[model samples]
Target: MNMSSNMLSGPKDTTRTILVIDDDSNFLNPLKMSLEEEGYNVITAENPKSGWESMEKHEPDILLVDWELPEMKGTQFIKLLRENKDHNARYVIMVTGHSTTDYIVQGLDAGADDYLIKPFAIQELMARIRVGIRIRELEKKIKEEIKKLTVLEMALSVADKIGNPISAAKLHLQLLMEQETVKKSPELVESLTSLFSMLEEALELISKYQKIKEPHSVPAPGGKTMIAPE
Candidate 1:
């Protein structure tokens, strides 16, 4: 796909909040406007201090950072952000004139998730930003699903361990052995006494989990509420 098309064609219900950190208003202004036009929420910071503050406040979905700044370079900024555990989820794309592999590696090591060289095409930048955002979204979804699976697996394991019918059988067997020692009739005392207690206890434990039977869910009134065609 072409650059702009690829950048703009993600699922529409979700969009990233982008932070553009560059002192060059000429670059920052246009990029911000374009990103906003494409349905992203764009926030801009003109200096390093302001950028850090914006990062803290907005906790942006993605960061577009200039490689060189008057006070602090982009690599250093990214390093600081990475070291802070709270900002670990922030995705960064370095904006720089340097296009070397070494520079790219430095950016990545400093926790830049992506990179875009300065004077780069707006379409290309947007495409990279789209990629960063999509990766983060997918990662989040995967983590959530894993959490749910872990919980379900734990529940099933507990059920398996505690729900065995052998527990009830063991209790009955112990009671029957005691009755036998006393020379009691197996049919009259052993069977009746042991089975009754086991069944009663099992039923009580089972009742704790079974859903309370509610009245049947009735459909809404008004003849099922038909809708007219548009």
Candidate 2:
């Protein structure tokens, strides 16, 4: 059955779908029941084909996949899902007997968001689920903020990139006028023009300072040239 897009709204819901893909019925059943008892809708598949079919039919929010399956390797299954555009939204966690760091790295490289070693604590598994949900929410909020900032930055950048100096000057002047209107600072306009002139003088002074060198020699008594002190 196609799970409603609105069904997995959040933690408040009565049931959240989780698809467990493990060839071992003993492990899969217990894990599914544990999550179901915690108010999640659980589905189990023994192979990648069934798992993919379940994912397409139910649109599960989370997929718990075993590292070893009879039909295909766990990493390969995950890679296939990741390469499919439609499956990109599903959050997959790998369950594996391979507990070494090398295996974990391989799972991540294959695009698993997280992994659980075989014989995981039920409580810890649930906690991981909560963390994943919270992270997804935070990620969504950050992406939205980034998008807004990108739009604003692009606008400012385009204004700065405009080639016409007159257009640039007009933009700056208009910005100053807007600021003055907001603050009611009529004198700011004159102050800014004066400040610009002062800034030009300051820049010239800096250039002159850079060009300055110690006098070649100091005049000594009897018109003798004395070398400058080192």
Candidate 3:
């Protein structure tokens, strides 16, 4: 592979990271400068090896790779990169001289999100980068929402796990407080019985949640509804 190690870099910051893989110094150096000026942390690699490492290390949200590379082609790199679950969501745009229909299809089939031809204007590239930024932000937002939903579901599950028992104990206590016999009974005996019953009730509630039940589904008007076993 006639790969060059002439890497031009920028300081890391809160800006979005972009990995550009191309064996051409003519393209790599200029692209890096343009991207850096636009407030993006750019990682450039002349070979697929260093590109892959930078990808895994930097976790770039956008990729601008040439179709032709040293030993490994752009499609090959993307094929291998997509296999790793961690990089499946990367926004890839091919930058090469090959703009044929077949090559574009092949690149897209290999998991590239978009493509660009060589000798393209810097302004156009900037516009595409902006689009990539928007897309990455949307993906980040969706993931955060999913995380919040998971936390809410967990909280509800926990409440469900403990809600019934606490309520039952409270009702029991109210009954005991209102009853004359229980209120007048030896304070020590009443306290011991009440505490023991509450604990037993809580254990029973927890066990109920632990038991596995067969799910039953019924066809609704528009969808299927699941009924939990009682």
Candidate 4:
């Protein structure tokens, strides 16, 4: 198996990377050039072994895999890629000479996002690639939105747990400050006033979290989410 890469020379539409795995050099080289011309970073691997290595190294967003590889069948290669968590999220398009319905079903069942019969038009292939790119982008965006919502849910839960106790404490402190004994000692009164102020600030922070319509957060140390202040 051989590996080659075509790095974009100048500014391009996007830095989306594509990996092509096919043992036929004649087919692989032209496909690499066509993809590069379409403003994609293209990596070519002549067999599944080199393809897997390239996948590990580059983590390309889209993959163009031939149905038959030197080391293993294309469907088997796709299965292996799908089983690995790191590479499973990629958009895989299986390219093969097989046009039978069963073959297409097998490829899709093996985790291919799309399939193209051999001798396909370059324009059709490009169109398919564009669709794959859009799908990948949408999936990424949805995952980020879910993460944000999860963080917001956690924040609201924390606020709910702490809000009641803080409110009760403030109420008791207010009642105690109104008593004759508490009013008589000026130093103690000052300390209690400061404590009340601190409690009020905590309540205000919790209120902010409770009223959050959209939560923005960052990953903090120790695998925690820290909500960004408005």
lDDT of each: 0.72, 0.71, 0.75, 0.88
Model 4 bad stretches (over 4 Å) = 1-12, 216-230
The alpha-carbon deviation from the true structure for residue 42 of candidate 4, after best TM-score superposition, in angstroms, is 0.8
Ranking by lDDT: 4, 3, 1, 2
Models 1 onward score TM values of 0.67, 0.57, 0.71, 0.86
The backbone clash count of each candidate, in order, is 1, 0, 0, 0
Candidate of highest lDDT: 4
What are the candidates' C-alpha RMSDs? 10.5, 20.0, 11.2, 4.5
Which tens-of-lDDT digit does each residue in 6-37 have in candidate 4?
33233344689999999998898878877777
Give a tens-digit lDDT track for model 1, residues 69-133. 86988889988888888887788888888899999888888888887776677777767887887
C-alpha lDDT of residue 160 in model 1: 56
lDDT of 3 by residue, 1-230 (tens): 21221332333234788899999998788778877766778999999999999998999978998889999889999998889898878888888888789998998898888888777777667678778878988998888666655644554477576877676776776666677776576885578576867767775655554452432334556675433223
lDDT of candidate 4 at residue 58, scale 0 to 100: 92
Write the number of the candidate with greater TM-score, choosing between 1 and 3.
3
- Give candidate 1's whole-model lDDT: 0.72
Worst 10 residues of 1 by lDDT: 209-218
RMSD of 1: 10.5
Question: Whose TM-score is greatest here?
Answer: 4
Consecutive 10-residue window with the lowest summed lDDT within model 3: 1-10
- Give the clash total for candidate 3: 0
